[model samples]
Target: MNLKKLLVLVLVMHSDAGIAQNLDTPSIKETSGYTLANLSIDSQITMFYYTDITPAVHFYGDILGLEKTLDWSWVVFFQTGSSSFIGLVTEGHDAFHDVQPSNAVMLSLVTNDLDLWYERLRQWNEVTFLKSISDSGPIRSFMVEDPGGYTVEFFQWLTPTE
Candidate 1:
C-alpha cells in the first residue's frame, strides 16, 4: 500500500488523538480558569467535536437553543436524555498539527425533526453534502455541515410503541 493510502486507512480506523485530548481537557473555558485540585475528575465520555475554523475556535461564542447549543469556533454543546454531555469545538483552539486551521473532528447533533432541520440547513448556502436519512436498528440519522466545514449529524432515536 502506498504511504498516502495507508495514512487514509489509519485515519479511517481511529479518531484523531489530538481531538480526544482536547475533549479530555479539564475545562475548555478560555476566559475561566480551573485547576486539578479544584476540578472534579469524572470518568465519562464527552465528545468535543472540533473543526479547522480560521481565527481560532476560541474567538467564537455560543448559540444556545432549547436543546442544543453551538459555540463560536469553540464547540457545540449538547446533552442527551441520559445525562451525557458533549462539546463540539472547532479546530485551531489548542496546539495540534500546524497553528493554522486545517481539519478538526466530526461533530453530531440530534433533532426531533430531521426533515425540518435538513430543509433549514439546505436554505443556508454554507451547508454542503446533505446526506439521505438512514434507518439503523433504533434510530434514523442524516448529516450536514456548518459554514466552517464541520460535519453535523441529525439523528432521531425511535422508541417502540409496544
Candidate 2:
C-alpha cells in the first residue's frame, strides 16, 4: 500500500472507467443520425469584392507574388499557402452585389525576411504605405494598402525574451 502504488491503481481505475464510458456513448453521426459526408471542409479562402478585378489581380498575383490558382472570370483565386487562398470576386456578379471596400479588415502575412519585404514594398509606387517598418514591439511589421483598399500587414514575430 505505498503512495506510488495507490496513485497508479487510481489512475488505472480512472482510465478504465473513462474507456467504458466512451464505449457506451454513441458518436455524433450515430446519435444525431447525420453523416458529415455532405460537408468536407478543407481550405480557407478570403473573398474580396471589387468593381473591377484587374487591379486586384495585379496587386495580389503580380505584386505580392501569390500564385494564381484559378480564374473563373468573375472570381479569381490566388493561392496564399498550401491550403489558404485569397479570392477576388467581381462585384455585382457573385453573392455580393452592393458590397464596398471598407478597409477595416487587416490581412496579416507572416514572413521570416521582414527587411527584404519592406525594401521591395517601399519601391512599389502603387502600394499605399500605412506604417513604416518598425521592430518596436512583439512583431516587426509594416502596413500597406492593396489595390482593393484592404490593409495588408507584413510582419515577423520577434523571438521571446528569457
Candidate 3:
C-alpha cells in the first residue's frame, strides 16, 4: 500500500474505541444483522371489525376526512398516512375476525395540528370524547370513542423527535 494509505489505516486501527467487532458474521435471528430476502412492505392497514359498519365508515371518512382508498358494503379503507391505512369491516359469520364485544386496539394518529383537530372534533355531535385534551410528557393528546367503540387518540409531539 502507499505510505499515505498505510498511515491513515494505522490511525483508524488505534482509535479510542479500539478494535471494532467483526460484522461479517451471518445473521439468522431477529436482532441486529438479521436479514430478509428482498422483502419490502408497501403499506400497512389496521382493521376494526364492527357490528355495524355504516357509522364507523362515516366517522373515518367524513369526520376524520381520510380519503377512501376503497369502499364496499363489507369493508372500507382510508389512507391515514403515506404508508398507513385504517379499515372498517363488517362483522358477520363469514368475516375473517369475528366481532367481539370489546376491542383492545387503540388507533393513535400523530399530527402537528392538534389544537385545530380538537376544536373541530368538539363542534361535532357525532364525536364523543373519552379523554379531554391533555398533555403527556413528550406529547399532547386526547382520546375519542368512535361509532364502533374504538378508542382513537390524536397526539402532537411537544419536543423535537430524534
Candidate 4:
C-alpha cells in the first residue's frame, strides 16, 4: 500500500508509533499577541468605496435585502444575519478616504434562495452581468456587478457544506 494509506491504516488501528507528535513551541498567541489572539471578533466586513454610495446601498440593502446595522452620512453597514458584514462608504471628505472606486473586491453571498435572488436582481436596472447562472457540480451560482462596479456573486451549495 502507499505510504499515506498505510499511515492512515496504522493510525486507525491506534498503533503506538502512529501517536501524534509532541512539539514544544510557542503558541500562535505569542506572535499575534494576547489582545489580538483573544479578541472577540463579532463580524468581518468587506468594505467598498464609491463616489456616490446611494446606488450601492440600494443594491445591497433594497435588492439583496440585507439588514442595515449602521448608517451615517458617509458609510453604511449591512449584515447577513451572521458575523460577516458588508460596508459601503463614500469616497470623500466625510470619511477622509480619497481612493478611486475599486472593482478588485468581490462580495460572495451564500443563500438557499438562489433563484429568488437571481430573479430579483435580473430585473434591477443597475444589475450588470459578469456570469450567468450555472451549476458546477457542488454549487449553483451567478455573478453580477453591483452599482459600485464590484463583483457580487450569489451561490447555493448543491450539497451541505462539508
- Backbone clashes for every candidate come to 10, 0, 0, 0
All models: lDDT? 0.50, 0.76, 0.81, 0.75
Best by lDDT: 3
C-alpha RMSD in Å of predicted model 4 compared with the true structure: 9.8
Candidate 4 — worst ten consecutive residues by lDDT sum? Answer: 16-25
Stretches off by above 4 angstroms in model 1 are 1-104
Clashes (candidate 2): 0
Is 2 or 4 the stronger prediction by lDDT?
2
TM-score winner among the candidates?
Answer: 3
Candidate 1 vs. true structure, TM-score: 0.42
Model 2 misplaced regions, further than 4 Å: 1-41
Residues 45-133, model 3: lDDT tens digits: 99999988999888998898899999888988999999999989998846799887887778878899999999989989979999999
Displacement of residue 119 (Cα, Å) in model 4 is 1.1
User: Residue 29 in candidate 3 has what lDDT?
Assistant: 36
**Model 2 per-residue lDDT at 118:** 89
Error of 3 at 3 (Å): 59
lDDT of 2 by residue, 1-162 (tens): 543563354455445355444444348557876555434569989887788889989998878888999999889999877898888888786546545747555676778988998888777888899889988446678889888888788877688699
Residue-wise lDDT of candidate 4 within 70-123, one digit each (tens)?
Answer: 999689999965788888889875765554645665676778999998898888
